[model samples]
Target: MQSDSDRTGLAIGLSLVALLLFDAMGLIIKHLSEHYSPAELSAYRNFFGLVPSAIALWSSRAWHAKGRQLWMRQWKVGCLRGMITTLAQFCFYMSLGLLPFATAATIGYADALFMTALAVPLLGEKVGKARWLAVGIGFAGVVMIMGPGSQSFTPAALLPLVAAFCYALSGVLARRMDADVPSPLINLYGTATSVVGASLLTLALGGFSGIRGPGDLGWIVAMGMFGGSAVLLLVISFRMTQQANLAPFHYFGILFAFVLGWIFYDEAPVDDLMPGAVLVAAGGLLIVWRERQLRRARLWGARGPHTRI
Candidate 1:
């Protein structure tokens, strides 16, 4: 019975909460990085994260309406996304251990720009000059944060950039999936694959370290809960409204990351994140705005000229 406006407001609120939960997971990952390898953490996260994905799938009315089908026409796409997600988590989690919390997170924002670029070849979508310009602006901001050739820049900085690209690739692949498949089901596929992939990666990386204490174990559980819940909320939000309506708000995560970093780690990398962060946000917002404009144009075109304003 909720109106479109009410659904949009709820979606936006849920999206914000999801972002906060994701940041909370990141905080826990950063805290535990000293005691665990990224591979181990990735494996643990995906393992526990599967619970929420399964629960979401089970709770989906649409999925239930479909007679609880377990098969997907694009199962390969889901598997590929899972593999990519495994790599993304490994790289991002590694960066969280090595870089400033905000720095790693800001760099990860490059995923938006990467997604735009990848959509062209990967999705066969046309890229307009405006969006390409936005990508350039965003890339420049990413480079500013990386600070290559500066003393502050290290090889470690590249980890988050790599992570961003993998994440973007995974997202782009999702668009190639069958539209009829439930998002929660797709998510479950990816998470399950990630679990296996991360486990193998952990074995290859010389295996997991022993937990130092129950505190670390508790933190691991909290990390998985935060991440899994975030994914669930994001899935629900996307279903509630147009993705473009929610896309721009993702930048809020960067601000939250910065605040959390400052509070927890006394990290205030203003000089490193200043105008660059502004440019990054502006570029992403511009892309979102352009997408919305194009969608509206398409809608109007489909409705014909006689449609009411």
Candidate 2:
């Protein structure tokens, strides 16, 4: 049998790969945003992304063992999540087009802070002083990157911040889903809804623009595949180990984004990201540390103080 440590190692590897794929998708979106509307790009992405979700659902052994159940109890919640995700994608894609790649990507990290704050009201979770302080620190970093009063700051910077909030809200709401419903199934519902929502958004935004060229078409397809495959890998990683084991590694994504932005776009925003990015990372790590402590405490309490380690 595979040891717990080995499984965790494998899960971390998969998580890192997933983050890289997600960053690749972001790169493609940034590249294509020059010619396509965010609404159209989102619609195309969801349409192609549905294939991987379907494949993941079909291959789910647990879902298959339960007779391939297709319906979920929280279908409305799934749809709402999809709608919110569409908004998130639209905003983030717009930011990618308007701002520097690294800057937009770094600002989007605020989603972690938003997720932590939202958990209090959304999940009825109690917030301790440490986590609250971490949130404040993370927000301060976000404000520094945003540079609200600085001459360089533009309202466009707010797009990724809004995107981060919507993304965090969608994630927090996912916790309310029926546990018995397979994750892949829930993902499919959201992806399907996103397809419809994105389509409507495209129509509202004056319909899809003609594909700029064959090369752009190819990039769009690649973008969808990268996103879909990342989601699939994440599902596999989640199944293999505890989420907390993988959560901290998500910070690696900022590093990946920074490197990619520097290499591909010649964007070195050291001045913009500097100490702010450090605080953002530190704050998130602090939250992760506190969550681990609480989890360990709960486990110890459940052992009745008499169980062996």
Candidate 3:
């Protein structure tokens, strides 16, 4: 049997794999988007992705979650969170088309910062002063990465920023309701919501006539495969590992983005990006570290005063 520590290590390692899977997903989606609108890509990805998701749910008998119907629960929150996630995914895809893989990944890291801010409002969760300070440090690093008012800042970069905000909002919602809903059910509903939402928007925006040719469809299929697997992998990791144990590995996505850019997209990583990347990463790292410390502090605080020897 795997020891608890061993499993935690494995889980953290798997989460890093999940992050790279996210990076690989960007390249695939970008290629597909060369021929498709973000909506069309989302529509197709969710539609095709459902086939495998359905199979996994059925095989694992995850459909019968707690013997309770979804309607009996907070269905609105789930769908709303799914919509926010859909929008976030859409904007991230948009940025991938307009920016280099690493650049877009770096820009999207702002989502973590945005998430921290939004948690206070949406989840009514109070982030201690330390995490708040860490958020500032992290965003400062992102600003260095972005270099606003310079040639590096462009209209396109804002797309990822907006995506980050939406993701932060959705993440808060997901965390609040995670225990009440089964992971598979959440995936099922979220996938369906994305497809329906994307379809309606596609029609409103003039339909999927320009989505892609056959070659691009292949890329979309591959993207959907990686997307589903990444979700499943990350979900498993969360189940097995403490987030602090998994947090450092999350930065592997940035490294993966850099590698993919050079290998496939011919993007040459630059020097300015490194310092900012390190700053932003360190800030985010501190945020997680402080949050973990606060949890321990609060736990001890609740345990009553210590008696003097």
Candidate 4:
């Protein structure tokens, strides 16, 4: 058996590896965008992703519990989450193709800000003034990236913001339904939803006409494998240690995305977007800090007043 300290270290290591793998998927998606539509690539991602999800489900014995269905108790809610996740990923993949990786990543990370606001209605969670302030700062960071009313505004630049909103909504659903739904089932349904949705949209757009060769197939499969593996690693990491300890490491993906962007695509954020990225990063850190404080307070309160006898 691993000690708590050993598990924590392992979690941290896994978290870092997961983030890198996620960035690798993003890089692969960006490269494949030259050969396929975002919708088509999304289909590929979800299709191949199902393979690992099935493996994880089988390995964990999550497909069927004692006398329970695979859909768990709340099948409707799970399906709704799946639909929301599909749209979120489609928007994100589109933005990945349309914008610089660093810029797209900065905006996508703003989903944390969206989630804070959405939590008020969805989760019935109270947002303190500090968190609201963090949310404001985060949105400001987004505007800095967008440069509203400026020549820097490309319609496609808004795709990531849409993606962020959809992601936040999906996260809200996931939190609400997490009690009854196992992670594997959640992943399975979500990937299935994406595959079907993307396929429908692609067919409506005139089918997969861009698939030129096996190279395209290879890129798509690689993207899917990296994406699925990242989710598995992230799930394991969170289960291993305190989530607060792992929360900060999420920003590490942005840094890696920037480095990867520069190296492969020779891409760099513009002057304004770079500053925006800094602000977004800061705001995200503030939110994480505030959450940690809240969690600690709850734990302390649960312990009752410490009698300094």
Candidate 5:
């Protein structure tokens, strides 16, 4: 077992790397969007993404008796979660193709706010005024980023909002799931769902007529490899660090995405998006920090009165 300090450092490092990989995956998606429809890209992403997920599952041997039984027990729930995730990813990829990279990414920070809000009714978690205030602040940030009624606002901007809500719901569902179901197994199911759903979507959209030969192969592979590896990195990181400590690091993806957009697409940040992104990040971080404090207090209370020398 790792010492507290060492574990903290490793977790932070791994979290940062994971976020970078996720943002890199986004960059690849954005590039490939020029060549493929969102449905087609999602299908490719899900299909190829299964590669690393399979490898991880096999190497981990998470299919042993109990694990296999747990997986079978949860397959139905997994399918539902996978369907939700596929929809969320499809909306996000659509937004990526339509909106500025940083803006789309910044809007996704709303997932934290949405998760907190949803947990109240969905998970029966009690929320105090301060946490609600934080969520409101986060929403204000989202409104600012979305800039409704502004000349630049497009209906396309709503895509990330939809995606965030779906993702948040999925997060809550995960919390309600059996802890014994391995993450890799869950990932496998999710990718399988995405593959099936996205393929149907592609067919509805008139199939993958946009394929431009072997050049598209690189983007497809990059999307899958980066996305799958990022999931593994996050699983490893979260295993080492507390979720609260890692939560704030997720916002760092916006920064990475901004840099990538500038380098690859020459896309500059929108003036309104930066301040809104800050508000969203600050509000979400405040909520996470407050929750951590509350958890510690509860733990301390459960420990009962202590005598000091």
Candidate 6:
């Protein structure tokens, strides 16, 4: 029992760490992109992040022995996830390059709404009316932020939205994957695959990008470390607390991105970011709350209806 408590506390800490780490990712990507192409940055992030973990796993003789599928056995599913993640990361990195980190981060927040909306058709999960309303309200707020009608749309603005959609799909598949394999194994393979693919794509486009020195190499490595730790910590977090309780914490990334933008890039957010942030954050919170409420209702809803006593 005490172990469970300890684990819970550790999980919460890891989760917060994961959120902050993720918050750093876009800013870091943006910074690196200044010196390296998106493909170069993406490759470095994916490759370095996996290589050390892979070595650690190898020395431990883990060699993915516990993965539900044999090496390459889960290729189809794994590859599907890999592709989505690859595109998502690329788009996100590109967006950071093109837009303010805070602005792009705000747009990315809509991924929860995408994921919630995605559950209905793809997974056959029943989305209650409240959840539907939440998604709609949240998306409406997104339009406000983007200002579709009044402002001319820039192609760059779509980057985060594209990233969100790909990520949402990948997220759903990840749940299916969790039932089959350890999260670490799945992530390890995916990272390795994504890095390799990204590198090849980069080289194919143009060879040997701005990797001209030692300092750049160090930041690339650091980016990898942050990313890897985040993936692992997030898995730990989800296991600790209920998704509802943990869900609101996602918004912290926006805050992290905002501060980083203000300090380093000197980029500040406008009034547009707040309303959407509030609506999306509020909608997500309410959806979670409504889920819990409905859960309680269900437990009692059929109590007297079907009982003969």
User: Which candidate number has the best lDDT?
Assistant: 1
Question: In candidate 3, how many Å is residue 70 off?
Answer: 4.4
Clashing pairs in 6: none
* Per-residue lDDT of candidate 2, residues 153-209 (tens digit): 999999999999999999998888988888999899988988899889999989988
Q: TM-score, each model?
A: 0.98, 0.98, 0.90, 0.93, 0.94, 0.86
Candidate 3's residue-wise lDDT over 1-309, tens digit each? 999999998898888878887788788887776777887777877777776566545534344646644452767777887687778877888888988889888878877788788888877888878878878888887777777898767778778878888878877777777575666666667777888887787788788875446776667777887877777778778778787788767777778888898899899657647788887788788877877888798877887578443
lDDT of 4: 0.83
* Deviation in Å, model 3, residue 166 alpha carbon: 0.7
> What overall lDDT goes with each candidate model?
0.94, 0.92, 0.77, 0.83, 0.84, 0.76
Instruction: List where candidate 4 sits over 4 angstroms from the true fold.
Output: 61-69, 178-180, 306-309
Cα RMSD for candidates in order: 1.0, 1.0, 2.7, 2.0, 2.0, 3.6
TM-score, cand. 1 = 0.98
RMSD of 2: 1.0
Global local distance difference test of model 5: 0.84
Model 5 misplacement above 4 A: 59-70, 307-309
Better of 2 and 4 by lDDT: 2
TM-score of 5: 0.94
Order the numbered candidates by lDDT, best leading: 1, 2, 5, 4, 3, 6
Model 2 — TM-score against the truth? Answer: 0.98
